[model samples]
Target: MQIAIDGPAGAGKSTIAKQIAKTLNITYLDTGAMYRAITKGVIDRKIDFADQKAIAQYAASAVITFKGQRVFLDGEEVTEGIRTPEVSEHTSEVAPIPEVRKVLVQQQQRIAEGTDVIMDGRDIGSTVLPNADYKFYLDAAVSERAKRRYEELQEKGGLNGKTLTDIEADIARRDYNDSHRAVDPLVCCDDAVRIDTTHMTIPEVVACVIDHVEDGTAK
Candidate 1:
């Protein structure tokens, strides 16, 4: 049972994926966190984003793993570290590089082989798991998505001095980058069930997806 959920940032992909995985007793893989791990690595090493070759090499050799919900990089726990605004800002740049995507996508596929996994990311349905048994494309209005992110950061105290407006701008920029990238850009697969979550609560969205999963039909 492989489930691929694709969406832009703050569309509630991670939250929804986690709940679905829990309900179905499957593993949840946050593919965005994997890219963020690499971005964090590059930033920690002070690598220049302009040097795509170096970044790609770093991504290829980076050891990223998920122990349950926590993310690890190079055998170190970086669950919170990778979620910093700095890492989020730079992940868009790192994720679009062909070489980097090649390396991470291969890793993601390997993890899903013979495993009941629910994975979410920009290109999961279209690129990483094209043949997945269940594919969903989740989306919401930019304002709604940004507001969700702002509240989440506020709760975590991870805002890093960023306001709601700043977060909104950042999300807008990310949407553009993810959609316009040259390699495996974020896209809704033709067979995927598209869910507009702008007006729905988390449980509502989760229940909608669960219905489709159990009945094998799009609601």
Candidate 2:
């Protein structure tokens, strides 16, 4: 069984997906993190993120490992390093390239094949796992999402004088870029169930998703 959770950043998909995977005893695939790892690679090498050729080569040749929730890039533990605002910016720039997306999508698909997986990302339900047993499009209000990021970035460090407004504007731009990008834009699949989490607590949202899974399990 596969559960595909599609949502924008800071929408709680990553945490929920991890918990859901633990609840279900399945592997959790954080596809966004894979992209972030690639983005960090490009940034570390001081290569142009917009160069489709460079990005594609890096993604195709890169080794991304996820053990439990920790992600490694090229054998180095970069679980937290790849989550910085700079890496996020690089991700936005490189992830839209068709070649990069193509290679990463292939790798993501390979990882989830023949396994019970909970995969979360911008295009999982729409493109990567359209045939998933359960598909959810998780969302929240912009301010709510921004607040989540603000608090997380504060805890994570490396904000570098960036305010909530700066994060909000970055998120807004990412929303536009993800949804408007020419290749595999971020959008909900018609068959995906939409879960608006603006007012719901974490447990509430997890319970809601568990209910869906329980129902599917019953079938």
What lDDT is obtained when candidate 1 is compared to the true structure? Answer: 0.92
Identify the leading candidate in terms of TM-score: 1
lDDT of 2 by residue, 1-219 (tens): 989999887789989998888888999999999999999999898887557797788888999998888999999999989888888887888889888898889988998899999999999987898789899999999889998899888887767899999988988889999999999998988888889998998889889998988987412
- Separately for all candidates shown, the number of backbone clashes (residues 3 or more apart, or on different chains) is 0, 0
Q: Tell me the tens digit of each residue's lDDT in model 1 across 90-198.
A: 8888988999999999999999999999999989888998899999999999999999999999998999899999999999998998899889999998989999999
* Overall lDDT per candidate, in order of appearance: 0.92, 0.88
Cand. 1 TM to true fold: 0.97
Worst window of 10 by summed lDDT in candidate 1: 210-219
What are the TM-scores, per candidate, against the unseen true structure?
0.97, 0.96
